[model samples]
Target: MSNTISVTLTVNGKRQTITAASDTPLLWVLREELKLTGTKFGCGVGQCGACTVHLNGEPTQSCLHALKDVNGKTVTTIEGLSPDSSHPLQKAWLVEQVPQCGYCQSGQIMRAAGLLKQNPRPTREQIVEYMSPNICRCGTYVRIASAIERAARETGAQS
Candidate 1:
């Protein structure tokens, strides 16, 4: 008898099906099965936000979500942020030069996008407080905050 079960997920606006152990984390499924490597794995325990992705427009730690839990749910990885890196956040990230080592950047951007979706005009303090959990070893918090603010401003203007 096989212990693996099939799960279908909507990721980055596409549907994918994979067979794996029920306990398999969404991080591995995204990276291994779907080949969406933009969502990095930092701390498997979810203390780090390297594996952040949007689940139904909410920032969620992929490392903490299991394959079974995400079945039938919509997930948006970094690739889904824009077709050509044209999302306001991506553009602002470039303008602000928010990446150093770049490992944690995708999660940072995803988390920021979620924040902006919820609160289009977050104050600097609110941005800092919400983003505090996403660890960036390169210490790019200032740049990250700047990019998020820039993106928020741009997004707000367009709305």
Candidate 2:
């Protein structure tokens, strides 16, 4: 077994201290260690964005992130994205009825959040480009794209 390291992280605005192997992926740490299971595991290899999360306000594949390297960092999962479901993305997704299988929605929303952070007023093509990394087996691409567009519009109106 690899040597374990202790680290502290602020996830969804909560600080936690955990001991894990340096190479352990953040996905496991969040779901198994911290019990924040909103982030799903689609592909362990990072090709699928089902395990995406936010690290210091940037979207990242938690499955590809090293636990030890995230010490003292801020991590946000879908649960954090909208504890009250107030995030425009979450609200827009609901308003648009975006999820089909529901398995990939969390990752898709997180990726959409990242996209809006960079471009709050993204075009349809832009939304597709930004969200291309996340794969939805349900093929909810149309609604997903529309949901992101909706979120972008909502966010733009807020600012």
Candidate 3:
């Protein structure tokens, strides 16, 4: 076993204290340690985006991100987006019926949140360009795009 370090990170607006090897991936910490299992494990590598989480409020691939890199930083998962699905994106997701198999919804939602934080009115092409990294096997891309558009419009209206 390698040296296990104590990393205190803020997740979903709550602080988390965990002990693990410095190289342990954040994905395992979130799911196995913290019980925030909504962040799914798809590709153990970083290409799938199924285990995406937020580091410092930016969408990040947790599978490849080391716990040490996220120490003392704010992390957000799909669960942290909103408790009651009150967030515009969540509401829009429900309204737009974005999930197909639901395996990648969490990552998709997190990525959508990041996109909304930057561009509240992204065009269709812009959304495609921005969300191209995450792959969904259920083929929910159309609904996902629509959901993002709705969330963007709602957020823009509120702002």
Cα RMSDs, all models: 1.5, 1.2, 1.1
Query: Tens digit of lDDT per residue, candidate 3, span 25-114?
Result: 999999999999999999889998899888998898999888778878998998888887698988998999888789999898899889
Which portions of model 2 miss their true places by more than 4 Å? none
Score each candidate by Cα lDDT. Answer: 0.92, 0.90, 0.90
The candidate scoring highest on lDDT is 1
lDDT of 2 by residue, 135-157 (tens): 99999999988888887777777
Instruction: Give per-candidate clash totals.
Output: 0, 0, 0
lDDT of 1 by residue, 37-85 (tens): 9999998998989999999889989999888788899999999999999
Candidate 3 stretches greater than 4 Å from native: none
Which pairs in model 3 have colliding backbones?
Answer: none
TM-score-sorted candidate list, best first: 1, 3, 2
Q: In model 1, which regions exceed 4 Å deviation?
A: none
Q: Hey, what RMSD does candidate 3 come out at?
A: 1.1
Best by TM-score: 1
